[model samples]
Target: MNTITRLFDFPYHQLEKYNLSDSLVTKYGNDWIKTSTEEYLDKANAISRSLVRLGVNKDDKIALISSSNRTEWHICDIGILQTGAQNVPIYPTITSEDYEYILNHSESIYCFISDSEVFEKINAIRKNVPTLKEIYSFNEVEGCKNWKELLTLGEDKDNQNIVEERKNSIATTDLATIIYTSGTTGRPKGVMLTHQNIVSDVLMSAVRVPLRAGDTRALSFLPICHIFERMLIYLYQYYGISIYFAESIEKISDNLKEVHPHVMSVVPRLLEKVYDKIYAKGDALTGIKKKLFFWALALGMDYKPYGENGAWYEFKLKIARKLIFSKWQEGLGGELELLVCGSAALQTRLSKVFCAANIPVMEGYGLTETSPVISVNDMRNGGFRVGSVGKVIDGVKVKIAEDGEILCQGPNVMIGYYKDETQTNDVIKDGYFHTGDIGEIDQDGFLKITDRKKEMFKTSGGKYIAPQVLENTFKQSRFIDQIMVIGDGEKMPAAFIQPNFDFLKEWGSRKKIAIGSTNKEIVSNEKVISRIQEEVDASNANFGNWEKIKRFELTPDIWSIEAGHLTPTMKLKRKIIKEIYKDLYHKIYS
Candidate 1:
């Protein structure tokens, strides 16, 4: 329990302290496959030995691309790190061009993949990536080598001493992983994080995560390529909590029923989807059932932390929990103790309602460069505050700049962006990492993010607008699914909305209104336009006249990652969105 310094030390710490029989679980077909801590270490060590045999050196880069998280990724992670190579976890959804760019940038010597799709992507770019020596797949692909072969090569124990030597030689400050930032603009930059950068983060952030330790189970579905989920993986291992990987995002509902996980990490986009599904279910009810559902929901929307609403509110909340919210708990597998929301700004409505439903949704804030945890809302004590990311975690210092950027200085800060001192220096100045996020620390020290500094824009009239804050608040409307506030060099601020089509269709049927099926049809429907206008007008009340959305257009398509309108993390690729919706943009400002 004591001497944990490096990333690999986490599993070893678990092996000694808990030695869990089900440290990592992944679903394959109908079976819930398990990899014990003993097996996890054994396979990792074997991969280490095999990599050594292949002449893999310290600081050598190895890239991993997985369609979804699996036990092999974790095993490969430990195995790769123990061999003193840096793991470059790449998003599976990105194009082959991105793969080639990151591989060449990191100078990755070996690449491990998940399936045939990923194998084909890498195979297509193999000629361009001359540094890549071999490709190994977790799932057997037709022409690709399987990872088991690498493990087979390391099955021999004689080279165990070499792995031990490599493990010992790896310092706490040594580079552990080279995470390529999902830059909305330009090529992705490699953010080089150290063992200390993450180890310190996991340890400090651990106090904020509520867990009973070894026995509790966690369901991990967030892209582990991102430090937010990757860091949580190490934290789960540190506490010996069993981690169950969902099959994929498409199958999360089924997996939730089977796993009944006590905890999971989520992004705001997922919460939006969950809320929509839950809202649709509620709307499907009839007569008094619908009335009761809405009454409970209305009570939920007025939620405040620590009983600030007094005894009467708590009594109604108790009834709401039994009559309404208990089903929300049951839908996500009757046993969700905590759902840590991160990666983007979560709508305050989502946080408030989820909390009122007896679902603890703690919002956290950080970046891949911070080794990812700067602050997180916790349920214990007075640690939580509504609409805030949460109190800053222990061992990290946060101070707002005069212009309102959240600057932080702490052990969790990254070593630097790999091979790019100029870009790194721009952000990390005077030992403080300028988060590029504008926020203010409240009197009680809860961090409330306003918007991304780079994203905030000044209109032609010199009126400044923070779109993300507006977007977050407006998304609280059940009708508006996604929105982008615009007016960068224009007369007034406006928006492009992607309405909650699911909710719209249900309401359409209920009201005997034909809102249509296709996105174009629904968006053009006069009734639908008027309804959305009402929601927009309502949300505009919270903003200044200059900042308020003056006129808005609805999109005929969802802004998504694959469509190139959104980044993988679900943040609006403002430039990309504008390019695609230029016609709509002109319609508003013309």
Candidate 2:
């Protein structure tokens, strides 16, 4: 087979070549379930054959709705692909409206769900979807067909020939998946990616971040439905690496300790939480221990990735590594060699600190339209940049537009937004996909993101303010949890702040301050407001007077996915936040 064809069909080839036993590990309740490569392939093949029997044709769309990461997710994904069908993955946390929109838009024929809860979710709106033919559940349900029954449907000898013919018929340019982008603005767009788009990315990324089969153990916690984690799964399979699915978001710490994985993928939000937990522990320490903890953290924060510090600084860092950061390593399973952070910009301070503590955080940049990875930090390639998203990967060409928007041209770019020619034309023009993000390419070829072109807003004084810049800066403060900087057509930049409640309560206790019973009372307290003001002032010191936040309102409520304030990826939904806090915004400016 040609290189492109081989790349497109590598997953199935790997399954056929690898041994049958003990290849994949999945977490089930308190136990780990091990499945051999052959076993996995058999199940996936059976599902593919069954799908064919159900009249699923090439280019047919299949929707999968699941919450937890399990072996069945991978099995069904591969199965769908084997039948030359496209997979439409939906986040389990998405709204019912989203479910209806995606199912109808994609014109999915078969729906596979994880459990009864997900089944019920689909069942509620099943009548609305005209194209959907059958519903299958990974777990046994009252009304849905069990996934295991698909194997029986494919038990006939003729099914094997059908499977081989289906696999052979698939071309590298054929549409592999129709991933709906969870856009922050307007309706979600379905990004259509071909086999070549994803396969090229998988291969290119593998070169940057090398992994060995049987040697590297990966702990998967990020949503598999998301392209970032989904792409990593294919990369892991390509190298024959063993993957352990994390039980849930809450169990990540415990799972890390148990798995002792060499590498893992994460979003910036998770890293922020981890840092908070670490700082909390340090704050809990007393006397000399507390002093040392703060000292080490300060040293970490000031660390530079590329430049050299003096011998004295290096000596102290060694001591900190041995004394303070060693325990941090242990808490993370003690074997974490690399952490691939994407989905959002990681704070430069956090990245530096973690690296100084001997944990390398490799930050990358991409959107759903680019088959996800356009650039990433490669430790072996001198591509590590502290504040920048590393050098653009091989086979991808990145250039800055006159307005500073990053434009990319590569094989990895999606064909088009599914059935939306106008939208497709808006982004992909002259073979370059406009990334909407304003960024600059440094002398070293590293990409430094400044702000989003669409997100920058001007105040009444005509001074433009980038809310993300201020929000990122303010979040560095231990007192702040989540913040949104708002000032479009206003006098000065103002903010709606969510204080780190746990940290605030601890501070209140230490100071013997009386925090009232209600959330509103606590947030509106003079002491609480004063403390948050100090934090805002500290963050504002780095900016100009016009850019500084003049006034702010404290919100006791946390922004979350269910509450519609955050996207599934944990990015703040600015429009939603504005609408929800319309009165609060007026109050801040008033």
Candidate 3:
């Protein structure tokens, strides 16, 4: 068995061990295409040979931008790395201006895009990038160079030796890829990660995921440009789990049913949406069905693992699982044994309820610089904890700083920020990477993240409030879809919220209340405001008086990545959201 030290080595090792027939699957039109391990390696090698013919050199940077996850991206990732070149994966939803900044900063020489949507963004700024020699499209677009041309060029088999030679010369510690963090504010920084960084993280994170050898399936819809999903892609390959790319974000439910994946990775926001959608269905039920639904939901909310709530409660939960929670499992593909949430803090209620429903959600924590998994909730052993991010994985050491920041030291940490020593030094000190998140490890070794050190703000009274904690607490309201706490230098804390419009409309209809139809009209409804206030008042009991939201205003729009209210990873772009809703911010503060 070959020791897997590099990013490309994962699939090759899978071929030796599992020889999976469906190594990677992507939907084309209405058909799902499967690529075997042998085929995946062959195509990846072809990509390498093709790049060699195109004058690509070791350490040369190439940029890949995709509007959605696809099989080509993984092939290109391996193909690019095998040639000793690093690929830069950028967010497809970012502005052309951001596209120009990252391409220029990384000095990417060749660019590959998934479709015309991503192509248009890049092609608009293609002239501004002096180092970008040519553009290739994975999906054929009008008057664009296609990636197949490279494969065709390499088909002659003449430069195959050169590709192998390049592979042999590449060390395990060599640069693998440059990922531009879709930052909440400022220009994005290219986080340079070595082959070992991701490979080690994948190996360490694998022990946490319970799966059968090469027999299970994974549905990947989260942006592959993000390290969380990308690293999981490699991990899926390492586990011999067949990888299926959801057609689009809109089609995840349909794809989930079609593939019936055994495992999936989701962000906290998506899980919240799933829970909300499920709750809305239950809300529509009549009579005894409705009564039983709320009964199960109540029991789920108060759930604890390892029968900590005792035998009678556990027996009631088993009845709840059969009566109601089973449908929740069925909705997410009947065999969904696990879902790992990350990129933001998950509500403890969401984790507890979901786990109680028997669909285990292991909320993990890490950043792109750490090759992403610093610590994650595990299902094996007694590692299942409801509130924490679970125990730190083996080989990764986490210690809480005096300021309550999590500082990590491990092989998985990135080499540094690409070409920015000062920024790198700011985060990395004394051989430990400063995580920027305030967290504490429990006596039982589970790690719980409290809040972002930088995101915590102070009031005029000198009281500090952790907005994430407050937001997560309030989001348990089900009425609030999105909330941002704002009170810096103010007399008291307040918030700007995006109400769950779906629930609002249904609730309005159910009560025969005229809350109106449009987002603007609904938010302006006095009754709607009063209803949400009750929820806020209910949630405020969990917080200190200073930490509670004194007042809040509803936003007339949804907070989304495409709307500039959120980063691609679904974290709130607070500064951008503030600017977008300046009028709403003023209304709450005034």
Q: Cα deviation of 504 in candidate 3 (Å)?
A: 1.4
What C-alpha lDDT do the candidate models reach, one value each? 0.92, 0.86, 0.91
- Backbone clashes under 3 angstroms, per model: 0, 0, 0
Which ranges in model 2 have alpha carbons more than 4 Å from their true place? 1-8, 13-22, 183-185
Clash list (residue pairs), candidate 1: none
- Best-fitting candidate, measured by lDDT? 1
Ranking by TM-score: 3, 1, 2
RMSD per candidate (Å) reads 1.3, 1.8, 1.2
Better-scoring candidate (TM-score), 1 or 2: 1
Model 3 bad stretches (over 4 Å): 182-185
Q: Write the per-residue lDDT of candidate 2 for residues 1-590, one digit (tens) a residue.
A: 22535233555555655553555688776788888778787788888888888888988999988888788888888889988899999888877788989999999988989999888889999999999998989888998998888878876657778878988889988899998976545778999988889888888888888566656788988888888888888888777777888888898999999999988998888999999999999989999999999999999988975547888888999999999999999999999888998988889998999999998999999988888999998767577878888989999999999989999999899999888999899999998999999999988899988888888899999998988888999999988999999888888889999888888888888899987767778898998999889999999999999999999998878788779888777888888899999899988877
The digit string of per-residue lDDT tens for model 1 on 1-590 reads 69889999999999999999999999888999999999999999999999999999999999999989899999999999998899999999888899989999999999999999999999999999999999999998999999999989999989999999999999999999999976544789999998999999999998889887988999999888989999999999988899999998899999999999999999999998998888878887999989989999999989998999999999999999999999999999999989998989988888999999988899999999998999999988989988899999999999999999999999999988888888888899988999999999888889999999999999999988999989988998889888999999999999999988877887898899988989899999999999998998999999889988889999988777888887767778888888998998988888
RMSD after Cα superposition, model 1: 1.3
